[model samples]
Target: MATIDLTGTDFEQTVNDNEIVLVDFWAEWCGPCKQFAPTYSAVSEKHEDIVFAKVDTEDQQQLAAAASIRSIPTIMAFKDGHLVFNEAGALPPQALESLIEQLKELDVEKALRESGQSE
Candidate 1:
């Protein structure tokens, strides 16, 4: 699937609707963010089941603040509407693929229980 541009308006709904969503919080002026765009898009094409969404922080300041984004090229992965992975930095294509593999093998409910997030 091609990456979708997300705004504050539809962000939450999109997450709720998708089983697995990868959100890339980025800005246009950031060199690393620009460099990461193609890599992100390329990976998105390989995963038709995943939602690859991008938020242009410059245009979505409130959303960025809500997500607590402190740096450009921050990537977040959500599974079953719960955040599973979050990190700041541009990942190489191989690393991103590896992360997807781990996420595929991950048990979200068990992870939440182990982390004491499940009540």
Candidate 2:
């Protein structure tokens, strides 16, 4: 599926509603963000079952803050309504693909416990 723009209004609901959601926090002026856009888009196209969403940091400062985005290109992955992976910086196409595989195989309950967010 094509990447969608995410806002604070829908962010929580979107994450909750999808089995797996990958959010890209970025700003338009960020060179690395620009460089990473195509890779993100291409990867999103390949993963039809995954929800690929982007939040423009400049325009969504509150949402960015909520996500604790300290970098321009922060990638956050959520599975089963829980955050499973997060990293700053751009990921190469292969790394992005590998991350998808890992997310698919990850045990969400175990990950949430490890992250100290188990409910």
Candidate 3:
């Protein structure tokens, strides 16, 4: 699947509607963001069940702010409506693939319980 462009208006709804969501917070000017875009899209195509969305930091400043994205290539992954992973920087293709596998194998209920977040 192609990466969807996310804005402040649709961000919450998209996250809530998908079982697994991977969001890339990026800007066109950033070298790392440019480098990571293809890897992100490639990973997205491999995982059709997951929603891969990108938010342009320059254009979607408000959405980036809401997500507290301080870096140009911040990657956020949500599983079962809970934020399971967030990191700043670009992940190589292999590492990104590993992350997707990890997210898919995660037991969301157990994770939420361990984090003290009730369902």
Candidate 4:
């Protein structure tokens, strides 16, 4: 699972179409983003079940605004077409692995019900 580039046009489809998606919001000029890219890519390679994607904030300003992303290298996880995790800062490889494990444990159906997205 390589990291896919997400643009304004394909943003919704990319997230909604996948059962579990992890998006990294980053910009080319950010040092932290540059440092985090390799870790993100490595994580993607390790996890085949999760769809990993990245959005270039400079090019996708509208998408970034819609996502309420104010910082560089924000990571968001979506499950069942709903946002499950949104956080800023760079995560170590081990931390990212732990996050994936946590996401796997999440009952998305139950979460959707609790969030009033389902009956």
**Root-mean-square deviation of each candidate, in angstroms?**
0.9, 1.4, 0.9, 1.3
In the range 1-118, model 4's lDDT, one tens digit per residue, is: 7999999999899889988999999999999999999999988998899999999999999999999998989999998788889999999999999999999899988978888877
Score candidate 2 by TM-score against the native.
0.94
Number of the candidate with higher lDDT, 1 or 2: 2
TM-score of every model?
0.96, 0.94, 0.96, 0.93
The clash count of every prediction, one per candidate, is: 0, 0, 0, 0
Candidate achieving higher TM-score, 3 or 4: 3
Error (Å) of candidate 2 at residue 1 is: 0.8
- The predicted structure with the larger TM-score, 1 or 4, is 1
lDDT of the structure predicted as candidate 1: 0.94
Model 2: worst 10 consecutive residues (lDDT sum): 109-118
**Candidate 1 on 10-109: residue-level lDDT in tens?**
9999988988999999998999999999999999999999999999999999999999999989999998888889999999999999999888888989
Off by over 4 Å in 4: 115-119
Residue pairs clashing in model 2 are none
Off by over 4 Å in 2: 113-117
Worst 10 residues of 3 by lDDT: 110-119
Worst 10 residues of 1 by lDDT: 110-119
